[model samples]
Target: MLTERFRFLLNRFRDRLWVKPLAVCLLSIAVAFVAKFADGTGMAKFTPQISLDSIEALLSIMASSMLVIATFSVSSMVSAYASAANTATPRSFILVVSDDASQNALSTFVGAFIFSIVAITAVKNEYFEKAGLFILFVLTVFIFGLVVVTFVRWVDRIARLGRMGTTIEKVEHATAAALRRRLNAPNLCGVPVRSNLEGLAVYAANVGYVQYIDMAALQIWAEQSKVRVVVAALPGSFAAPNNILAYVIADSAERTDIDSTAVALAFQIGGARLFDDDPRFGLVVLSEIAGRALSPAVNDPGTAICVVGTLVRLFTLWSEPEPVGGKQAPKYDRVEVPELSARDMFDDAFTAIARDGAGVVEVAVRLQKALGALAASGNADLREAAEYHSRLAFKRSQNALSISEDLEAVAKAGNFKTKHAESVSSSDGKQQ
Candidate 1:
């Protein structure tokens, strides 16, 4: 559990600009010390024959040029992020900003630059003896090699980083991973969370999204107080003053205020919802992107179609059976939380696309086919949701299209169970 906590903290820190560069600089300095001690310790004999002055010149050039390059890289990334926000959905900007590859590449470049500056300063100070000099020279060459590799990789990644298709793929991957995590530990591996509770309702003190719920702490308090706790709001849910954040259920004889504050502290309320615990947010973002693409100014029906395919992939994944057998018992069995609804996810994924792209015959046809395919996924809830959206999209297409042929095409593709009866009624009205 401590390991998991440490892992969570490390992951949270890893995406930041300072963490990796600081780590790389410290490690480089540690190597410099190793080189200092190993200078005349038969290590220099095995080291390369590069001269100190040559190494210092290279380091100086790298230090100056790399600072410029790093600044330019940051600027380019900022431009790309702005473009992505404008072209794609702004909700996905966080993922682009926190890109692991981009962060790593930038860190490597900046870290190498810092190492160069420090090495150059040390060399000018005559801190390194000839043997130590040879070691630093070798490390400098290694750093150069690292810089070249990182630059090549960064170039490739930056070219595609903020493109609409690439961003969609990135969001989809993040969403799928989040969904898998939820699939494994729905309700945070606790009993099913319920909305109803007879216990004392604990309201939030702030207005924000419930970013994370620390079930471990809740279970601890529940265990200590000899009561069952029911979470009223899960992660991604908005919380407000006097809103029930959770319900504290205690025995009739027990006092209520014992650990209520501590329990409240466990919920990590934040300004925005996180993508990790909120699959619905991901779906909404994808739908928003599709809606943007379908706008008259954009008119990119292909993107909407791609998003439809992605949604189908997501729902198919959702339909898979969750893996069985955890190594330990459920961590917070006494805490009850609600399961995510397939219906909500579907609406988030499709409703906007259907409404916005309704006029485009190609988009409408693809939407029908995509929904029909999802309806065949063998999950009853998914089928029902898909059919419902299909009918709504069909009706929207009917209203948006002025041409009779386009309307008929979308109606034909609807594939609703009542299609025959509707067609018959329409024929009767036309004949009258």
Candidate 2:
């Protein structure tokens, strides 16, 4: 029964677009006349001679005020309604957050008292003395209120459309696999590639705030390589490199395209951040190998790869292997985990990369040194296992390096080709 009632209400609201405006108009008219009547006799004791001119002036003023007030009120109401209707989450009522209930009540009381006092003063001042004018004032107020209500509703509709227009713009400019592919051609900067892929494709892309890129290119690359690509976080959202932004299937060819797209996208987005001199930009690449170990929902073969990818990336970033003598020691102590922002992690990685030039050989050498030190210090039996795991890490690092190299090659080639072509065209013009 409740469901049926709700359905009915929704249908009614949908059908009667003018219901709110009409109701506001009626309420405004009632308030204007009631206030006038109450003040004329109950509050104000003075009575004056009625005159046509006085009636006309009073009616015009009251009508104009009523119309302006009603228009603003109805506009606010319509905007609130539209916002509530379009939100994904359930709308909560406006709750008073303050704990001072007494103060709030006192304020309300004082406001009402002041309004009454003002109304009485207006009456005593003989603002509504003409009887013929009173009738005209009431009629004029009603008509103006109606006009205000209608105008307000129109404004609300326009506002809602404006909000939708912004959302559409974001989606259009959002980073997708397909978009990455289109922008992949040789350019001044280098070949574009994607980096740090993780997460399912559920949320909308946020633009301008943070990680904004063309997702269409990535999607195209994914399709060509037969990899499933999915984006997770909304655009403008602050995220760490290890944060799962999207998930990609790791079919070899698809993986290559996916990695390429991811790397390109990272460079584009991160470079943009650098250009803007925003210190919060960073990227983290997750290996799909780890994605294969999680539960089906958490690791949905198709769209859930990023969940596992994120886990792997975090593990690589923070975990320390236990001593070799211990029972396959835990990589990380739960208690020691600190809440670190993406910017912090990226900063650390950036510093490391800068010290070592971000070359594949340099990164691998560093990782090996770090791993070797841990192994020798009774941290784990990684020496024997280091070769296996290090190789995997090397592979991941190599992919990143390849993307960077490809981007550079494309950039250099494009520059050389453009310069040569320009020179040739100039020579031809000179000969002519």
Candidate 3:
């Protein structure tokens, strides 16, 4: 219900590189002291007497080694982040920054370093008896093993982390998740408002992107106020004071009961767009990567073509059948929510690539065929959008490429015909 705001905050928190490591640091400190309680477990008798010097020596090695390793991990990850932004898109930096492997590796390094420091200090100050020292030693060995395993695995992953392919993969995964969430709950679990609201329009308190909307909260408010709320501004939408976020459909007598502050609070407006609930933002960001690849400075048509295929894979998700019970009745029927536009998604994913790679015949051909694939989807909306974009890409290629043979290949790949395919000549010179 109030998950939208929480989800937004959680996503932002994850984007910050320090959050996970700091949490691990605190946990490490806690575990260092908590291990003292194990002194009374009578477990120390089961093992040979371990000297404090041995533990201190091991901790000293870990403390010094871990500090250096943590510094190295940070440098390597920051380089990867910079590379991803430069090679892909600046918008993709968030994805690279929040990579679980990278973050976990960093956390393990820093957490181990802090734990070593605390354990060394404990041993030096005689903070632990023999039992506690044994427990700390066992935990230290466990952490050491963890560090080795994490470092090895992370090294492999970091090798390709910032590469174009990996970045593209990350973007595709994010887009797919968002697409699935939206397709499953197209109305944001609310009934559709097909007509104009005859009630008061709710203006946003600030001007920014509507990053999230707590529809359940709004539904509760509407129920209390006895109104049918129409959500006008959805996640990924830019909201200004002049823009209407929702329409509170109520009689004049019910209007006085509405709390303006509560309504505005329901919509989480932020300076940037989020991918959690906003599938379109993902599309736009993916397109930005493709656009950057298509740019003359990069001249990486292969990446752009790869991106087109990735985009096709994403759109294909839309045609897949819903899971069991996915069609359940709207939970927030008191509130109205709008669905995403297939056409707009098409524009988001393809328009920039089409325009940017117009002159590149290979990119053009691949894009045309990509659109053709989408056009073949079972969904009529997708088919229509694909058909329109196919013709558009074909037109751009025709204008950009001077060679007749290149234009012919592009057109043939597109398999495009006139608007009235029934009456107009087809690409094969036959009317359908």
Best by lDDT: 3
Q: Which ranges in model 2 have alpha carbons more than 4 Å from their true place?
A: 1-15, 39-44, 47-51, 54-432
Q: Write model 2 residue lDDT over 1-432, tens digit each, in one string.
A: 143235424433533444444454455444434545534453333334445554445444543454455455445544544543243111111111111221222222222223333333454566554542354345444544544454455455435432323222222222122123212221111222243444222222322333343434554555565555434432334455545454554545323423343423532232122101121222211112112212233332321222222322332322334322333221211101112233343332223322222233333344444333433443233333433443344434434454444323322322333543454466568779
Task: Put the candidates in lDDT order, highest first.
Answer: 3, 1, 2
Model 3 / residue 28 / CA error / Å = 1.0
Per-model TM-score versus the true fold: 0.92, 0.21, 0.93
- Global lDDT scores for all candidate models: 0.81, 0.34, 0.85
**How well is each residue in 272-304 modelled by candidate 3, as lDDT tens digits?**
887788888888988998898888788888888
Return the lDDT, model 1, position 247: 85
Q: Which model is ahead, 2 or 3, in terms of TM-score?
A: 3
TM-score, cand. 2: 0.21
Error of 3 at 367 (Å): 1.1
Q: Which 10-residue window of candidate 3 scores lowest in summed lDDT?
A: 417-426
Model 1 off-target regions past 4 Å? 2-8, 44-49, 194-196, 253-259, 324-329, 417-432
